[model samples]
Target: MSGAGNGFPVPDERQLDLERLDLERLARLRAQLVAHDCAAGLFYDPTNIRYATGTSNMQVYGLHNPCRYVFVPAEGPTVLFDFAGCAHLSAGRSAVGEVRPAVSWYHFIVGERVAEKAALWAEEIAELMARHGGGERRLAVDRLDPAGLRALEARGIAVADGQEVANQARKIKTPQEVLAVRAAVDGCETAIGRMAAALAPGITEQALWSHLHQANIELGGEWIETRLLTSGPRTNPWYQECSGRVIEAGDIVAFDTDLIGLHGYSADLSRTWVAGERPAGDAQRRLYAAAFEQVTRNIPLFRPGVSFGEIAARAQRPPERYRGLPGAALAHGIGLCNEYPLIVDPSAWEAGGVEGRVEAGMVFCVEAFAGEPGGREGVKLEQQILVTETGPELLSARLDETLL
Candidate 1:
């Protein structure tokens, strides 16, 4: 856990201050709720729940099931509605005041009784709101089904967009949160190094990608959010997941590690490498140089006070042949997941762009991809960056020197 075989240091979990991290996150959420003039906030997204409570249970499972949630009053202690018999998961967390069995009304769980179950769920939540809302009925909900929404509305409760509140609250990271991000990136870079070392001819792309998964888990990281490892012909088009095709010598292998690492923080970094220690082809070199240049140039534009549109306007773009290729952005915000503040390609700015200023404590993923219109291979390069008061700090600095 301390260091990988490739000599990259893996952070020790004991060094993180979990309590301060948890409390600060909760405080941020509460402040956002108060600013939005909401009496309480209801969270169904596992990422939002984790941000507000610092506890998790069946994170992936909870995402699709919608059987777990948490309630946070603007000024009171938070309560977690956990999965059946799973209340014990938050036993030692000070941010969570109470744990109760959740009411699950999803069709898969309730069948013909969805409405009944939803009504029951609404009654409990309404009772809590009455007691803790200080006579206010405004409830911000991250996500809910139509039935659940109707059930709450029938009781005269006003529903607001809780996802926006959560995102704005999470936009700025505390100092403790930054430390957590650094640790996740350390573990992720170590895993990436391991994956690169295992690259060889005759290995299937899937087989090679598994090294990253294994190393991440062995280092106490959670799940990977994507399977974007491809080689040679599969590398073009860029969104192809890892397959069983055997990689031959000199094939360009490209991958994006959309890894959710330690403490549920993401370490999203991408790289391309040539197999078997062979020199890259002329086309490969050109593609890689373009991607490398784009990432390096865009990263420095993430200084504090810079607007997202400004960054997009000033970003380095790929060549004309590589323009409009799918599956990557100029830059994006990264946290427990790919959160907010996406800086898109300038060409698409008029339609898909958003307005926001880059601020200190915000982390971003700067990305670039270079693949010719009819080429058989491509290069994808990305770097994780932390925006500080002075400038941008590169979090994942492990680049493939040979490929570059």
Candidate 2:
């Protein structure tokens, strides 16, 4: 399957080093802000903050506290409001033009100072906006504290949903972004390969799950998104997290690697396995076959000019026996996290999926699950794909031959 038989012109074969805040990416994001008619963009979401300024401080801590933020004006310099006295964290590392200390105790339970902190945070934001000519223009914020919102309203700065603007900006992958995601996938594949080798009977699900976490941390990745490793009957309904249950022989084990890897890019991949050295049972084999078919069959449906609805219509859905399983969408876009364009079956297209055409440089994860109602175990498979001008290009590594 080469040449124009797939679709449009094939993209160039170029490689790039993963620089999280390359100049081009920053410029493109700022351009998107301007295009959205935003005077300035303020981000409290950790991912959005990093995307805007290429700086992250106490990210997990900041998720609950709105003290860390990034501000990007439509035509001026970028700024990072650091948490507490951590302004030095982003001084020379990020592309941001300015770094300021803006501390807030929004998550603290020490009396009512949280609201006072929020007001202070809002006042600092107002001052920043005024310095950047955003006083009379609208400010878009991805997440805001209630008190901060009130203060913004008092200051007469119209606040819009910055998450929408950020999502649209991030929907398309720049060359460097694609490269970073590929690097993240490479790291995840390495970790998964190690896990594959370590899989065996009598190993606790927690032990196996720890291998992935350890490997990811050693490889400089951020925390994983979920604890989705389980064995045997626990694998049936799909939302089970890893536990202390010892994996028995002939049991089915499944895991989803919703990992945030190198450079803050996400690599979402899933694999299922049999615990014993012996081959998978007939029913397990059938389930695996169905899941594999679902992933491989629907990949080509994603390409430039293909509408999400059409892809949903043509996608291979879960088998009838597994119709009641927990899966909701057949495929979805992936970037810093599971981003956009959840492609569903035609029956669910209007309800769950968005209406838009796939374009070049969009990355997606085609997901599939198969398990009977009240069954013992389930099979899950996922593939990371890049929608190129020509067709869908697989970014994830192939499953181990033994698993097939």
Candidate 3:
């Protein structure tokens, strides 16, 4: 636990406030939409809807069903299109100007189902736009079924991809958002500490993994976003999900706690530890040392106004022996989920890389990995950060370097 300390001077749990949404964030979204020239925004992605409207109901269900959505006019108030009969919930919890019943998939019977629903939805959307002085103006959408898109077009509303605008709005953290993310990371660190105290040989990866999940649930976390917990050979190539394979002595156990925790923000941190009480063998120490170096070396480079591509160019590679292991980007933005401005290897910069200059209030995860290509084990490490007016602040706590 050396290089990166907690991103903020976190208060104890009893004194900490974890509420995530506020009028300020919603205001920021409206401003971004206007700047993008989006007369109004129609958001169907569950996360986008949550960001724009500050309401949640059966979110995972809504993700695939499209039963719930949000409509935000750039210059006026926000509106939520929740499932029928659920307006009260939105009214109770959201800052929206109005709550309207949307066509839930449950109501589709058979004949002309999509057409009927789309027409109904379009009518409401058009009325809302017209009320906001945006008659026949552009409607940016994050996700919409083809039937709905065509219906909006038929209704004379221009539809375009609004995901980037949503990302831009959410990229910078409000003060409350920062506090909420801090609380999430605190919950995550507590869960990880529990796992470390309970670490031992013969524990199944499933059982070890459940400790974090249980702790997160108890701490008011919404969900565990990934299943990446593994040990031994499964740890080398990366992305191997947790299995029933029993951890053995001297094995290296690694996991990315991609947990969606308090206030619906994410705490995405990774750690690798040696199984059992004994000290690591030579190979374990070698890989772990390399990973530690790669992670710690880059934390200072994420200052305000720094270029993401420049950081990518200077990113430390896996120690020479582990050069070619398959892995994702070295790092990416984290909020409700891995959001934007992915920092990748410089070699891939020209091939669809997202370029941007880091700014104060931007949160990023710095990642590093080490393994012999096609070898038995590897190490993965990541640290959450907040780029500030001064410099980068480490949001995540220090890892147990002794285990590595």
By lDDT, who's the top model here?
1
Task: Give the alpha carbon lDDT tens digit for every residue of 1-404 in model 3.
Answer: 12224232222444333234657678878888888888888898888887877777887777677788888887787788887788877655545788877765334433457677678778888888889845647988998777778888997888877898899999998887887778888878878877886789999999999989987887777788789999999997989899999999988999999998877889999999888767889888888888888888888889888888888888777666787876757778988888987888766778857788999999999988788887899888999999889998988888567854
lDDT of 2 by residue, 113-137 (tens): 8777767777877887888855555
- Quick one: best TM-score, which candidate? 1
lDDT of all the models against the reference? 0.90, 0.80, 0.81
Clash pairs (backbone) in predicted model 1: none
Off by over 4 Å in 1: 4-8
Predicted structure 3: lDDT: 0.81
How many clashes show up per model? 0, 0, 2
Error of 2 at 28 (Å): 2.5
RMSD for all candidates, in order, please: 1.3, 5.6, 3.7
Runs of candidate 3 with Cα error greater than 4 angstroms are 1-20, 105-112
lDDT of 3 at 46: 82
